[model samples]
Target: MWHIWTLDDWEKNIDLERSGHRCGLRLRFDKEVDSEVRRACKEFAVFLRREYFFPIRVVIYVKARERIIAMDGDKCCGIFWCMPDDYTIEPYIRLAAGDYEKLCKKWGKDSALTNILLCMAHELTHYFQWINSIKLTPIGKERQATNYADYVLEDYAETREHP
Candidate 1:
């Protein structure tokens, strides 16, 4: 099992000086998960930086799979890949057939920003797990991924309420 506190530690270690207004988050989930998922994540990351003063660049890659596999014998689902230094948003946008102008029109600037922040936080949490040498069976990793997604959604809602 991976430690959840890894995310908390990353949050604390953020270097505000290097953080920027834009994030290049990538998701590696099923392509069928909804085209908006990537958009939401990028927007939320932007929101976190703008509102909380923790600027960051989040790049996401959403990979499509025929079926989710379990890391172990457990019932977890979904997998994510992330890197701290590789914050490039262009590739992901191309994969998802998305553009900035369309997102801004659909979600509004503020909402889109917040969505990116949320996604970045979630993906970064996974990166933390990887960096900490946390290992999860296939099933366990899948479960963690599912839970992480839910947590991100909840966090986005909370942020919106208070922001």
Candidate 2:
């Protein structure tokens, strides 16, 4: 059920930044996903490029699971993870597809997409923390990511609400 995207899978219209989007994104989906999921993920990729200033290829594993939030390794592997920690270089993001559906049911389609966007932002925060964890304790890293996710989500909502 996992799919990989290289140059072969690159869509012509996909917006990869020139100067900063350095990471070669390798993706693995537990099942088929939509264009919005891909798009939301690319936003995270862009964030990584602009923020970290390093070229680290990352694999994202999207899965359909019940009641589980997203995780960025060092945590429970969701439903369909096969490999161990060795495969975690640049580390893979495990996103909860069921959570997306829950957002849709509770809010709406737009809200669901935004929820995924925030989740992506959240996981990206984890990646940065994981890489530069020397300056941060375990609790501090989690706190930073959580605060970052909340701040980004609020900013995003405000932008959409006004614009």
Candidate 3:
């Protein structure tokens, strides 16, 4: 069943950086999620904050099939929204937990989390572009995001293997 959540429904919120009055890394997970999955996601968010800077919030919806539709009206794994009022509003990301689970079953937990992390990284790339005023065509943006995600995952693997 689809359970809509308000800002108050955030259970996995974290402040990545708080230099002054800026908010950071507001993460939310559905109440029905497994503890293991929740832990992994939280840890990954912290890792992302450390590795890069972008996006102020992330919401992961549980297997609510209809609730996580993209702008094209098709079911999507994730989306990153860039607010119009850049100075007053910050970007945020949303991910589908169902897709994460499917990847886990097919690729094992760590690999699946890696995939989900790639999705998050892709969204993050958009935020990076938005903040830096980097302009690109829609196709160029997607290609860049995909390349960035792959670069991130490769770097992560190297860190794990060497460190």
Point to the candidate with the largest TM-score. Answer: 3
**Structure candidate 2, residue pairs in collision:** none
Q: Give the TM-score of candidate 2.
A: 0.56
TM per candidate comes to 0.39, 0.56, 0.71
Model 1 misplacement above 4 A? 1-39, 48-58, 61-79, 82-125, 161-163
Error in Å for residue 94 of model 3: 0.8
Which rank order by TM-score, best down to worst? 3, 2, 1
Error of 2 at 102 (Å): 2.7
lDDT of 2 at 89: 37
lDDT of 1 by residue, 1-163 (tens): 5436333334444434575435333334444544565555555556544533212333444433222333453322223444534433221211222333455689776555444444345445555455334578857755675577566567657765632
Which of the predicted structures, 1 or 2, would earn the higher TM-score when compared with the native?
2
Clash number by candidate, in order: 43, 0, 0
Write down the worst ten-residue block by lDDT for model 2. Answer: 2-11
- Residue-pair clashes, model 2: 0
Q: What lDDT tens digits, residue by residue, belong to model 3 across residues 1-163?
A: 3211112222233233442225446577777655666676676667666765443443434332323677888776678776643434555677766555666678887876676667766776766666545568999988988988787667666656321
Candidates 2 and 3 compared by TM-score, better number:
3
Residue 147 lDDT, candidate 2, scale 0-100: 78
How would you encode candidate 2's per-residue C-alpha lDDT over 16-60 as one tens digit per residue?
464333455455665655656566655555554543432345566
